[model samples]
Target: MANHKSALKRNRQAAVRNARNSHIRSTMRTFVKQVRTAVATGDQAAANEALGRAVPYIDKAATKGIIHKATASRKISRLAKLVNGMA
Candidate 1:
């Protein structure tokens, strides 16, 4: 219940941000999952491809402040290692 006009606007802004952040987070997770799925199936080419795609999206999430940069980097590193190990 936002009483003031300013409060109402703030609420609206928060709603939009929430939606956007959630979408970004979900997409990023999906990409990560794709990588993991490929890795689990022991598909070297597919794992490499998924890792390549996931890295940029993960970095984008960090850039948008949805995730910490270190966390993003760690995720990318782990995914890369999984793909590499498939070789």
Candidate 2:
């Protein structure tokens, strides 16, 4: 419980931000999972397509501070490698 008015406002803001951040993070994970699933299924075309969709989601997540820039780069690199290896 926040005693001060500003603290109460901040708590409310934090709750909203947490929900928004969670959505972004969940979307990012779904994109990444799609790419991985495509790769695992040995569908190069599908994997490439999913990877394409995932890159931007990943970059956006990084840009929005949901994930670290390096982590995003690493994920992109790994996904690319998987897709490339399928060819």
Candidate 3:
């Protein structure tokens, strides 16, 4: 437990940030999973749509420092490739 006023404030801020980041991270994972599910279902249109939605979330996550830029690029690339390679 933080005893000083500044330490307490910092703890509170950390809690808030943790909550917010958790939400963003979970939502990002959900979107990515949606893309993967669509791909696995072999629905090209749905996969493309899901990828469209997921890509921005991933980009935003990267921009916000939630994910690395290269990781974001790789994720987008793999998902796009799966969608594009679909017959």
- Say which candidate scores most in TM-score: 1
lDDT of 1 by residue, 1-87 (tens): 989999999999999999999999999999999999998998888988898899999999999999999999999988888889888
True-structure RMSD, every candidate: 0.5, 0.7, 0.7
Residue 4 lDDT (model 2): 100
lDDT of 3 by residue, 7-66 (tens): 999999999989988888899999999999998888888998999999999999899888
**Stretches > 4 Å off in candidate 1:** none
Per-prediction tally of clashes: 0, 0, 0
List the pairs of residues colliding in candidate 2.
none
Candidate 2: list runs displaced more than 4 Å: none
Clashing pairs in 1: none
Candidate 1: C-alpha lDDT? 0.94
lDDT values of the candidates? 0.94, 0.94, 0.92
C-alpha-based local distance difference test score of model 2:
0.94
Tell me the lDDT of model 3 at 16. Answer: 95
TM-score, every prediction: 0.97, 0.96, 0.96
Q: Give the per-residue lDDT of model 2 (tens digit) for 1-87.
A: 999999999999999999999999999999999999998899888998899999999999999999999999999999898889888
Q: What is residue 35's positional error in candidate 2, in angstroms?
A: 0.5
